[model samples]
Target: MAGVAMQLFISHRVASTDVAMAFMIQSMAFVCFNKVSTAQYFVWYLSWVPLVLPQLVKHSGRQENKGLITAAIAWPFGLAHWLAWAYLLEFQGYPVHLFVWGAGIVFFAINVWCITCLLVRVSSS
Candidate 1:
């Protein structure tokens, strides 16, 4: 798939952890935008998160760099919001397709913002 191709290409071009993390974030975004996404799909990228946690925490420790900290927290919060909407639509049989779609779009935006923050930190460091 395209994600695999992207990973392979990125791996060949750069051997930095920042690039690896970027690839994982991009893969996660791809799954988020897919027509059908399941909880398990998240594992593919989530597994890589811990590897970068130290880097993220290090950057976020600076009080002036509020964006990194906010992004770190917001990413998961955005996921939870999307999951709540999805759960309502899937389990409660609510006519909330609009809400689900809206949540998904918002989540995608959050992902973009988070990735931007990550890349900025990576470039600066």
Candidate 2:
């Protein structure tokens, strides 16, 4: 799976035990949130965008600033997930849309931060 590959790649890049496990826990959370709509499916994928950077880096075989490039490609999903969460919250409420959106925002923010920090560190090194 892309998610597992992502964890392994990042773990190798930084050699951080905490970062490695964080990806796995997040992957499980994304998987466990079963039975969602099409939009929700994309958002779920977006939530995993941060982890995917390392996988993309590995796949690309680029030697220079690979993580930064992959994070750039993945950035739109993070922004889109935030916007989609907002739209869903306003248009509907039957499915506790507000709660879901809030959760999505939190996930998006965390992933965005993680990816940003990782890319910055990787780039500066």
Candidate 3:
């Protein structure tokens, strides 16, 4: 389901960065809307993250925080790690659901920041 939608989004992109961002955004939305998320869901976006990393690293920006852009893209994985660990602990009868929810909020915010940066980049170009 998510995989098919992700493919459709990625296939329509005309730019390398666009493709990478498409994958990232699609994966984020998929996980957000789904009932359960596994580490494999994170892998879907992490695989494409590297494709966009070099572009961000090489991007020449005067007012942009290249580090923020990078963090925006990378932070989701860290949150995913927490989510996975939290889920593991929860399965062991610990009350750590708040960690999952908090990670989700943070991930969404970081993604929004990345999307804003991308929009600004596109508009300026």
Candidate 4:
């Protein structure tokens, strides 16, 4: 049901902004439905991140200035995902643990911030 809604949201094609926003919304939604989620679940959205990266840069219009700041946000988001997955692999045989939970929350927040930046750009434009 949630996945379908996300797909429907993505189906709209008014602009590149719409695609980027839809991707972000769907990514955040992935975290919403699951009570217990692994880092693997985020793989779907991580793929979309690169696709939206340029959108952020282009919209911001400050690659020389905000470029590093944008990258600063992005690198940690990616690292957090990697760490979450690493935790997942180290205990593949075991059930979901507290470590992933903590990482999940942290990463989710970072993703939300990333999405928020895109969203703000969209609204401002």
Among all candidates shown, the one with the greatest lDDT: 1
Candidate 1 lDDT, 20-105, residue by residue in tens: 66666666656755778666887888787778777666745464367867876887888899999999999999999999889888
Worst 10 residues of 4 by lDDT: 7-16
In model 4, the runs with Cα more than 4 Å from the true position are 1-17, 62-104
Model 4: lDDT equals: 0.58
Q: Report lDDT (CA) for all predictions.
A: 0.72, 0.52, 0.61, 0.58
RMSD of each: 3.6, 10.3, 4.7, 5.3
Q: Model 3 Cα displacement at 55 (Å)?
A: 2.7
Q: Which pairs of residues have clashing backbones in candidate 1?
A: none
After TM-score superposition, what is the CA distance of residue 102 in candidate 3 from its true location, in Å? Answer: 3.2
Q: Indicate the TM-score of model 4.
A: 0.51
Whole-model lDDT, model 3? 0.61
Ranking by lDDT: 1, 3, 4, 2
- Summarize candidate 3's per-residue lDDT along 3-113 as a digit string, tens digits: 576556544642454656666656655664566756677677667767766655566576765645575657758676667757767777677677677776676666556
Candidate 2 per-residue lDDT, tens place, 1-125, comes to 76567556655655553454346435434443433433455454456557655654553434445555555555566556656665666676445576666766665655555455454454344
The predicted structure with the larger TM-score, 2 or 4, is: 4
Colliding pairs, model 3 = none
Pairs of residues clashing in candidate 2: none
The per-residue C-alpha lDDT of model 4 at residue 26 equals: 63
Q: What TM-score would candidate 1 get against the native?
A: 0.71
lDDT comparison, 1 vs 2, better candidate: 1
